[model samples]
Target: MISVGGYYCSGRSNGHHLQGVAMVISNRLQSSVVEFTPVDECIMVMRLKLAFGFMSLIVVYAPTDVCKLDVKEMLHAKVASVLDRCPQRDICVVLGDFNVVSGCDRAGYEMSVGPHGSGADAGSKNRLLFRDFARSQKLRISGSWYQRPNPLRWMWYSDVGNAAKKIDHILVSTRWRILQNCRVYRSAVVPIINWLWLPSGSISKLPSGPMITLGCFPWTG
Candidate 1:
């Protein structure tokens, strides 16, 4: 919970400190926070009081693609339950590392995925599951709707630095066009993906508000 200029909320597994997810809200926006709930080790929900309406931020870190089918199904079910509990009028956002390769195919999933996704693992099991979940929930995969450089496209790398893949995603309610731009910053020091949103007006430190940029970076202990 080391957020220099913000408030940090994290959820960790009982014996696994590295297997969890966290969220950080800027100090300026701290007063708008309504409640924070750690659904489990891998999922967290934060509600905020915004100018226009309420907002729900569901941050998650799903299991790897190699995990068992039941495990992946359970994760998606939990996430879906969380979304269902949120108010229908609130601006809902789900973002984090899904650890599933979402390939560059927008034929059947045009409403969920966009045209600017990477061309790897086109119809992987995890990819289909992810896309189907998005479609079922009527959420748009906002991160894949932009064209970025090759370096900025991948979010994870292999131990030997020989392979890389894009496993991070930002899903927003399809009814709202709040996502302005999404970018992945792969740094040698700090690896983070930033999902920018310009909802209506400006905030204290961000460009626009109601909902601002949410950075779901990993904080190792």
Candidate 2:
């Protein structure tokens, strides 16, 4: 395994050999890390000391629509536990490949989600689960708030390559204002593509104080 940053933490799953979650703490940010907890292959939490107080960043990879209901429920439970542990006053940012398409319907979820979301799939239970989590945690769906071009909004494409959907997302506390510049950067290429190429869906930036950048890429076998 190649290591780029200084501190590395990971959680591996026994059932699926390739299923795992990891976080690489940059040397510059290493000193701010209060604690890092890897709940399982699908979830991890990192607490950092900020100028104001503390900040909790929870990264997750939820099961896709094909996964069983029990699997999705378990993942949500694990994520909720981590959020519950975070102090209420601290800023919380939950992000990653949710694998759920939150449609552009902001009827009842006007405060939590925006109307700029991509079209949603009718049969995805993951969508409902995500909405519930956002409501419970009082977190706003950061990705859905920005109005961008169609290509920038879609984070996943159909296998046949005809259609696209916004499956990945970044959810942050509503207290922070999501700048208009926050958008998904599609077609971004890594410098080491000559030796090892990875498909990247989007690069999202939280252009707030100090600034935080997050990238979402799914691994395909």
Candidate 3:
């Protein structure tokens, strides 16, 4: 069984339009969902009760690099607001299609991003903002820390241009030394393009266990 969550386009009298963000949770994990909130069409936050404490998961679909600067700023502000409200002790994990590339620049940002990023630098303001946000939150981009093959690292591929980019990401709070491994999950038969796996582990000998496996696919339709 699968539990899906997201914002659905409202049906109007003129026509039915559906352009929104969504997340699916398996039945085994559904029981842990404490609450979920839809911040807007582009963002959603879900909380889950763990064995020892709680965890906050934020899912976002940011505007593309071509969008107006104000639009991108507004979205980030909204996301930050939601993040501020989360409990300080809760393990926070942010994941989604950020539409921004962190690249392989792991100079001063060694704490936030890693060296396994892909694609050329488009010099997008969104990318800068995302990096700054991660730094401010003390969150580490989990996928970037590990080295993977080119095809496995890139989350978005342009068929027309024959280009691939690593725009999707999974971030975890630095305080929790819980993320054991993170990588893109690819399969010939599955429709899911990006998947993150976090194995169960104890935190500070507190037995704060919750093995979270998340899969995300870009909404093309």
Candidate 4:
């Protein structure tokens, strides 16, 4: 565990220098952290003691769209195994840059996606895989639950500034009402990132739940 500016960070570095995943918790809630496990360079798990039971947080940097299908499936399988081991009573949240565009069509995926996604109508291989994973796990895409402008949904942009894609996402348990709002901030000099605010009283006694941030960086195939 490492502390920086009153925040505790946990993660695994695979020596690639360009790939890794981490979770940062505010010092105010440091006492709540009961376990932190680094699954791999691309995944990390953190458990926090909550008023009711526990909150399991999985931070992941999934394979890009260009990667082979088998490679992408492997990461999802690893995440699934981790989720299976969590306590049934724990609040599970899977958040990260999944690098897939889960379009707004809720057709058969009513359990996983909401009514407000922005992307391709006909699902791509990556999109379909991501959606199936969420559906199988009974998790909802947090950003799609709340309505936002289409532009705000785009989480990645091209270097030429002519194209943008909604790849980064935060998936939460379909049963929890913890997230109040999710906002994306676009900057000319930095890659897009999302800020999620947990409303007061959502997480039992923890009135001020930890604010979660998901960031996406440019990647080349």
The best candidate by TM-score is 1
Worst 10 residues of 3 by lDDT: 188-197
Error of 1 at 135 (Å): 0.7
Instruction: Please give the ranking of all candidate structures by lDDT, highest first, separated by commas.
Output: 1, 4, 3, 2
Clash number by candidate, in order:
0, 0, 0, 0
Best by lDDT, which number? 1
What global local distance difference test value does model 3 have? 0.70
Off by over 4 Å in 1: 1-5, 12-18, 121-123, 187-211
TM-score of each: 0.84, 0.78, 0.82, 0.80
Q: Model 3: residues >4 Å from true position, as ranges? A: 1-17, 188-202, 205-210, 218-221
Of candidates 4 and 2, the better by lDDT: 4
Ten residues in sequence with the least summed lDDT for candidate 1: 188-197
Q: Per-residue lDDT of 1-221 in model 4, one digit per residue for the tens?
A: 34455243344443344546655556666787888876776677788875556788887788888999999999999999999999898888887779888788999999888888768868388889999999999998877777767566777879999988777787888877655666576653222223333454444334554464433332221
Model 3 agreement with the true structure over 3-28: per-residue lDDT tens digits? 34532221222333333455677777
lDDT of 2 by residue, 1-221 (tens): 21245443344645444665545555656777887776666777778875546668787878988899889988888888888888887678787788887776777777788767666536667788888788777788876777777766777778999987777777777765433344666565100000011123212333234443444443321
Q: Estimate the TM-score for candidate 4.
A: 0.80
For model 3, how big is the CA root-mean-square deviation?
4.5
